[model samples]
Target: MEENGLLNDWTNEHPLFDNGQGDKLSRKSIAAIVKKYAVKARCVNPAIIPEGISPHSMRHSKAMMLQDTGINLVYIRDFLGHSSVTTTEIYARIGTRQKLEAIEKTALSPEPGSLPIWQRNRGLLEMLENPRDVVFNYYL
Candidate 1:
């Protein structure tokens, strides 16, 4: 191999991820490579590669990882070759864990004394305790 025009001892004719002809691997070739590695990985641990894992799933995983890292959705859209940001917005939907994390991060802790007197009123507590006793006057 050559590094900055300086010859090195590394002597592989093809790149580690290239096709045998020193060209970029085709989509099918890439899928085949992923499948081969997945099979090998399954031998080590079946949970590593679940059934029906495909190249598309890897792409989706990468998109999710990018979203989790706070990368802009527009950038992720471009990276994933989406026609519009709307298409990329699917990945922006927060999971349950992310929703909880966001809530925890922004949760407010107010002093008990800061609440209005109405909030602590016994009438309000009684109303909550006996919802069936309350009558609705929607016309009013």
Candidate 2:
């Protein structure tokens, strides 16, 4: 929280990840450090870990995790410090399994309490006669 100025908190204005010598760790160095940790984790859990994980993939996973919780892409963009929303929108793209799961949630049935008008009114028969006008959507 303090490193990011989040929750209106502060832990000395010093850089959070600093080299032992005294200066802040550069972005390249941070990536290397993250990879080192990933390698350590991979050794402990070989079955769960992939061979070539990096900090960038970790960032992508974080963005996707936030999207999974239904956070808006605009907010995600800001949270990731992205200059454009398009950059953040990539995380919102759903996988095929996610799409299938979402589709499975819909209950397929006729509109509740709304009987087909054409069934009772002969005048409305044109709706059923015209294929273009006949909408078979059951999940509203």
Candidate 3:
């Protein structure tokens, strides 16, 4: 398609891929193309393409790939034209090993001799001990 100049003239007025008549390809046309290629790929390797693969599945796979490459969810949301980053978070799902690795990577290690702030503050400790007796001011 690139060799045929279909990919060269992309603009706001022109779509990336189009039908022969200079119009955008319909959803059915795009699905048919994907299915055709998937069938051909399956002939070469039956395990490569799964059954019931659709354009939406391809889109999800691309989103997951982008997420796996460390791309931000906000960026992925914009790339996928999603209205909300929360919607894009579906692709941010990680496996158990990935979750553990991420947690370990970000795990906090306190300084050797530094005490926690609550332990160091006598007034805060008193406040914790007797909440009603202590008058907490917003400025403090």
Candidate 4:
């Protein structure tokens, strides 16, 4: 996997993450850090953000982006560690959002209408309707 660049394991020196440390990062602290950095960067250049963007938004955006790339829902569900597929489905809001967008884009989508055999030839229904024609066609 590493050779193919599919997956990489780098838990050894994660700054925010520690081994055997029960202190997980609190959401408030992360939000404050994100806000501080975002504010500082925007002060230098306001184009760094639009407005009201937070770390949680960025994380959700990343998850949605991953789901939009055709990754399996089951895999995403497992990655998020949901107790049930239904629970994992909450994280799949992005996928559903994309699906809704697609439906809107293809609101006037075309259909096959009918199969080739249905249009070109008689089937059991036609045969039952006209037994003589069916027998004559079969003989011919």
Candidate 5:
């Protein structure tokens, strides 16, 4: 850092990361370091990592990875620092693996002839509250 005209006396600077014995660097400096290494890595192996990879993009990938692991949407929302879950939902794409895992985890559907009690009744007075589960009886 000294050779690059950067400060080496971190004792006074409040940095997010420090070597404990070295000068502290601001967030901008940290990001610049990452950007520098990314450019170097890109030149070394152009196909290993994307050319445009950045700290923010790494955060996005982490959020998507959490969503792909079948984590609760609400948890993912908080993890990604979104003000609302709707925003986080934008990153939660249900890939084929998740879909298959969800299907496998669900309670096996009752046998064809052995429908649940509500299905046979079609529209019992008590079932009127929320019949969305009865898909077969609904036109939609």
Candidate 6:
């Protein structure tokens, strides 16, 4: 399994446990490696990463990135090797990133104390019918 002398051997280096059936890298060892790499990645990108991040979060983030671009859930499920599509659907949430981007792209900034003309008809009727109750009844 040698490829450019990077991995000279693909077999396990040591017995997994006293049972002597599994590979050298146990689940605990893989978990520790994942945690170590996660910490290293956080150190490199503190602004993008949040506290208490784990290895799974990276998978979730990748799925979310694809989801934001309107990628298919089935493709994402297969990419993540999920047994069920439902598991992958959890990563499709339109979180703060998409919300903020949409708002920044489409938000209309009205002048102070002035509604957009699109609402002028409604405002005019409200003003003429009941100006006093307009403040109490109008809800943004």
Q: What are the candidates' C-alpha RMSDs?
A: 12.3, 13.0, 14.7, 18.0, 12.5, 11.9
Tell me the tens digit of each residue's lDDT in model 4 across 3-40. Answer: 63435466333444322363556778778778888899
lDDT of 3 by residue, 26-132 (tens): 99999999999999999999999999899998898788778877788899999999999999888666533454455446545447897544446677556555555
Please, what are the lDDT tens digits per residue for candidate 6 over residues 38-118? 778878887755666665776788998898887888998999999999998897777545644554465476789985443
- For each candidate, what TM-score against the reference? 0.56, 0.59, 0.60, 0.49, 0.49, 0.48
Which parts of model 1 are misplaced by more than 4 Å? 1-16, 102-140
lDDT, candidate 5, 35-66, per-residue tens: 89888887888787776677777877777788
Q: What residue pairs are clashing in model 3?
A: none
Give every collision pair in model 4. none
Backbone clashes, candidate 5: 2
What lDDT score belongs to each candidate, Candidate 1 first? 0.68, 0.65, 0.74, 0.61, 0.65, 0.66
Compare candidates 5 and 6 on lDDT and give the better one: 6
Q: What's the number of clashes in each of the models?
A: 0, 0, 0, 0, 2, 0
State which candidate has the highest TM-score.
Answer: 3
Question: Which portions of model 6 show Cα errors greater than 4 Å?
Answer: 1-27, 40-49, 100-140
- Candidate 2 at 9: error in angstroms? 9.4
Q: Residue 136 deviation, candidate 1, in Å?
A: 31
Rate residue 2 of model 2 by lDDT.
46
Instruction: Tell me how candidate 4 scores on lDDT.
Output: 0.61
Worst 10 residues of 6 by lDDT: 14-23
